[model samples]
Target: MTPFIELFTPVSIRGMTVKNRVVMPSMLTHMASVNGEVTDRLAAYYAERAKGGAGLIFPEATAVDDSGLSYFRGLSIAHDRYVPGLKKLARAIHEHGSRAGIQLGHGGRYAQPEFSRSARRLVSYLPGISPEEDARVMDKEEIERLAGCFVQAAERAAQAGFDMVEIHGAHGYLIGSFLSPFTNRRTDEWGGSFENRMRFAEVVIRGIRRRLGPDFPLSFRLSSDEFLPGGITVDLAAKIAAYVVHCGVDLVHVSAGMIDTNRFTGPPPVLPMGWNADNAAVIRKALEGTNALVTVAGRIHDGDTAERILREGKADLVSIGRALIADPWLPHKLETGQLKKITPCLSCNEGCVGSIGKNRPLSCAVNPRVGFEQRPARHVENARKVVIVGAGVAGMEAALTAARLGHAITLLEKDSRLGGLVNIAALPPHKDIFLRLIDHMSHELVENGVKLVLGNAVSAADLKAMAPDVIIVATGSRPVIPGFLKNSSAMTAADVLSGCPTGQKTLVLGGGLVGAETAEFLAAQGKEVAVLEMRDEIAPDMQGRARAFLMEELSARHVKLMTGLEVRSVDGNGVVIVKDRYGNEYPLPRYDTLVAAMGYRSEQSLCAELTREGMRFVAIGDCVKADKIMAAVHQGYHAAKAI
Candidate 1:
């Protein structure tokens, strides 16, 4: 047997044989055409992942009905018109020797109201819909119609040449809502007792099986634990799994949480790796002696962890979601004993999930070529000598890209290390996973033969001496201290994070991602920390789930949060803040330390000098604009390609 026996081993279910145990579970990319049709861009995205050697490629959650749509450009199988595009997608996967599966889902109550076209609006959508209104509750007719939609979608998937179909009965979608009493509060046969609540799922599964026959493979994705009050527990999910298997589901893909509860939807770095493995194990044991295969998803990034889960009988298959996004060739690398070459997912959620939330095409922070699959960089005939200032995320990415394109590259950093702000950002609690990116990029730089110059600042005269063909400025940014507080004896958040001395009590001046994280870092160090924000909420820039996790951590540490407070001025005693509730100005209690976490400003001095000299140069990352890791990495990759 191979070293990663459990992970590399093939598994068969209901006449379908997967090449391995590595499954690429459904993840929405929002790259479909305007009419919810699969475009070439979407097909290329899945084809790339399938080429990476995953056993089963389950494309993103596709809506079975128009009312179930969640994203603006989400894929759909609502009608026969979508069959051709889906066929192209299925062929794209099959050509790469991987089995393709489509996840049929209905957003249910959590579905976007703007996208729903059903005559009966979900009760959660409007204020006027009362319990007595037949439109509010899914009547028997609507339930039958919904089940028929699932069956028809499954048939279309089979027609599209898909090897299997997955019923998305998780994440508080329509089927999941019916399974949980928390969302299904109806007095009909679909609600009340456990058997009644599961009736909808059983009906849908049996209907699909009746239409598609038992020869075709069918998988059911379930939330093994909703992780909310009045939600389905592991025991209930086990029973549901047993019932679904009896109803003809060949596989059970175990996941956790619902959309209403953000934390469990996508567990961030703060949560432990393989956070849902225990729940999956419970369901797997419940289905023991059955023919159903169990697959688990939730931070199962690497081959080691995936193999462990299978070897321990926790799950039969491991789903790699964001990890495959960060490195599409992850499975191929793992199989070929090139595990060190794999770029791990940071779980930052700054790009993948965050992009979807903002109604944009999904992209990866580490891998910028995600959405732009058709536009790969072509090797230049005449390779130019490129000089990149600042060995930060952007600078390193630019250097690596240029070097890969046969260009001579030099990466310069004034500091002794690489990873400019990332080094400081990773110092916070539960954020050490971010350092993996720096390590991966650093290794790439050396492998790609990019000249690395550390602890050396480059000047305009030095650039002239070097005579580089093109220069990329990624000088990064500096923390901003409001002018009103500059004169006060307050240190920037960077100083505090970089091991500067701090008093027992510290007040963080901003409540964005940086400020909130800085406050948590200080609180973890036994400091009495308080965060003041001008906005109505804290960590407004962070993803919903990650922000919730951070907020909970801060609360557990007793860190104070003061939102909608404008800082007036800072003095030797303390800072003066104005409450936005009634425009009341007051002085905060005396505090020994005042930390300025009020975000950053671009450092464009080098870029300005180069522009003034009429040098062929491009500015990327913070020097261009102070944004998150996504913008910086994307800018770097494109700038390098342009050069």
Candidate 2:
């Protein structure tokens, strides 16, 4: 028997027989063309995941109508002109031996006005629009047209050789808006009563069924619990699920949360794994004896957890969303009994969600080849001898990549440990998952025969003696102390995370990701923590959902936050601060400890030394730029590949 018996078991939906129970649920990747056409990049992205051996590969939510676009580069199926490009995508996935599926959705009131030309015109005619205002509501005629649009999109999917089409009624999309009372305030037939609210979904499913017939599989993605006040409840969602199943829906994909509220949609590291399993179980039980297959997606990253969820009858199938982004070969690795080789998703949202929020192409922190699926590592005709300084994420990645390509490699770390700042990052609450990167890379270095040296700092003289063909410096970065706090007894954020003792009252300088997280860490340890930010907002670099959750946690823990405050000078007892908004100076509450979280400066001394010695070396990661893990790992991967 397979180790993940339940997860590896094949399941049939309608006439389609999926190879396994693993479902790659829909996640928006802004890889399509600006005009909403399915580009080659998008096709390659899905094809790679399909090649990774997932049973079902559902592409990101494709807009069913022009006004339904949520992002600038969202894929669309509103016209027949898009059919050819979508056919290419479907064929690519099918060629990789995975069942191809597409999610059809309408953003409705949550749609981005800038993405739709019509939306911009409508906005111009309306009163002053606040950023927080809801999107323009569609009238009865528009709602009917959207239902027809879904049917046409499903028909197009059938033409594209897709095995299934999922109606995206989750994540506060168009159909979801009609289902939730929080978004639908209309007194018309589309709102008010529960049955009336679900009328839009019922119409969509019936229209698609009528167009595609009974043989084609149709899946419905629903938010079993909106997780917001006056939003759709679990019981209400179960009722809707029963109604949809009765209306000829073949599968139910359960999820939770609204995009506007940011209450759910993607669980960050702060939330426990399988946070929405109970919601799926409720709907699954509600739809018992029905023909629909129930699937749940919410932080079901690992095979063990996915298997447990299936074995315990939580749902019929499990959806691995972001986990697939981190390592597309997760399913194949699990089936081949190489579970340790699978890269883990840290749920940091730094690359995937964060990039999407920034309107950039989606990538992964652990996996560098996420967006560039068409390009694989080229084989070297003659491998070179390589030496890497530092065993951090970047150094480990460089060594592993170079050694995998038949190069002789040696990795050096000044510390006794393998992970650099990752060790400090893992010390935070619910962030231990980051240590897996170090563990995986260290194992790969040994498996690939890369020599690793620890607790020994290598200098330019040492490199000259070795005479390496190629060198990579990933010495990482050091914490920066603002000049104003130079002589004061201020400690770096690393010190706080490394178990430095804190007093009853602690003042944290800097309100970026590091500082905010450090403050939370101290507050968790029962310290009275106060965060001081020179900027107007705290954690400006953090993703929207993550920042919201972190602020709420800080508030719950009674951590004081003082933003727009510039430090005048540091004293022995407390620091004097000036409000940047006004010119008012004030003395804050007495704080015994002052921790500096004012970001980092690149450790470029070694790089400068290598340059002076005229060594053939390249600097990657923090040694070149003090950025996030995404930049470091990406640079390391590419640098080694280039060599």
Candidate 3:
């Protein structure tokens, strides 16, 4: 019905056809065995998505040779043992009318020590790249062997019933090293000139085609630009695109670099989101007369944008990495005219990219069901009567997840509308992304039939009146103020955040994450602000990169912070404080708002009451113990699974 629905329609590539336009591109699911065998968990995970109705599934990068894999868990086609499980996965995908494709790769220089890191010893010398080049480089014989390995992988893909094959030539991997001026320094036939630079890459493409023939649907993922000055520019990328298209490739998958230089280019505030489409489009134009599909994305959230890009000829296909993690059903929901109901990707890069660097599995900050969808929330399976007190993030997620599983639910909120703290929390500077979660989760609960009870906490009497089979106490938390600190005009950070009414030239109490961020928010509002904290450091709890950015931003905004200070009392004009760190006492002029951003105390009393009622109870959100959204969302999901 919507334009987005058209994007979800079936499309054919070469000899194979997919059920929809949506493609879950190659992200390392990390579900492979250490020895490279795919497991049941991996197969079932892909099957669940197939059953959920994805058009095509390109399961992670499949290393073509043993030395090519950089990660211990990366899937590989280097051995025949990888075939049977690949067949099983292919079958599962086909059962849902979807096609499966394997992206074969080789990590030349960036080999992980965890997987074949020692194998780099056998590689040869580098010739032209930067000083950071790994001493180990592939020799001519190794290049030839890897080419054959790629062909073998192609043959195996076909034997295992894969619909197509994509060559992993981007992301600063081995293929990328051979392509980038900054990484590949070979002087032989495989390096030096632009033609030499593309030699090894073209060899892989030509080799796979020699094995699978013309109609096998071979796709090549190419980094459009190295993002560095001496790096492969869009100009060089066009030539590279032309070369691959001429080598019998059926698709050109455009992407950018892996690390430094080409990291975040294209768009502003580009950790991820709508930055790479223009580059993908450039690649698409390069192959205008050729018969090849072009796909591009660094960050794109929700279905409308995906469809609009396709309709506008921005890219033949749009690949979503971050958004899908937020909500796997994004495409299906879009196809069914449910765009507004979709939970948008925040593009925070918190768990997805950040955690990946830390060597943990990729995850989404907002969507807890990402990597562990095997045991997703079971709504009210038996249609039990459930009454949930306090509608916050955790309670909302609980109610929504439970109701979807077919439960009769009543969500009680003391506030007139949902989004307990989110309504105010999002108002802080740069908290727009955090705010989106509230709107999304609230919409999902209300639309999916969670009954709303407004204007009161569920009193003990009210709980008895409901006589529910299940009761969830999620009354949330309140700010903590230390006894020694005294500002008569002071209010909790919630009051300032609520924008109820605060004076100017105020001293914010507490120099933690909330205090720092609130100070940043206030400074942006052109208010003179100063912060007083008892600790030595400020915003110690924030993520490293984000914290750095916040500090730089606060500094630029002229926000003042006084650490190692203890407040004794507050008068109408100012607050009395002692700085033991500096051994001095002074009354900083406040005149306006005083805030307590120290911390929150759990409302476990309500949870204890429900526990004594002999009802199946779960306490979530701030009430269960205040922490980050990660703990809150996961607790809500797993807790519902208990029922």
TM-score of 2: 0.95
TM-score for every candidate vs. truth?
0.95, 0.95, 0.84
lDDT of each: 0.86, 0.86, 0.74
Off by more than 4 A, model 3: 120-135, 260-273, 350-367, 371-383, 428-436, 483-485, 488-599, 608-617
Across 168-256, the per-residue lDDT of candidate 2 in tens digits comes to 98877778878877767668788888888889899999998989998989999999888778888999899889999998888899988
Clashing pairs in 1: none
Native-to-model Cα distance after best TM-score fit, residue 10 in candidate 3, in Å: 4.3
Q: Which 10 residues in a row give candidate 2 its minimum summed lDDT?
A: 120-129
Worst 10 residues of 3 by lDDT: 261-270
**Candidate 1 lDDT, 59-176, residue by residue in tens:** 9999899878877788999999999999999999999899999999987765665665553334233233223332355668878888899999999999999999999999877888
- Scored against the true structure, residue 270 in model 3 reaches a CA lDDT of 22
lDDT, candidate 3, 1-643, per-residue tens: 6567557766767857766677777876667787777777777677767776677788888888877777747788888888998898789778877778889887766666567645552223444432243335567887788878888988999999998898888867777777777766667888888888888878888887877777789888888877676677777787788888898888788777664543342221325355677777777888888768887766666676677778878787777766676777777777777766777776556666556666666666677777675665543437778888888877887788778878788999988987777676677765676667887887788788999888986667679888888887778887787765453656888877777666677678888878887888778888888887888888887655566667778888888878888776665554555556667777776446677788888977766775676555678888978876666677776666666
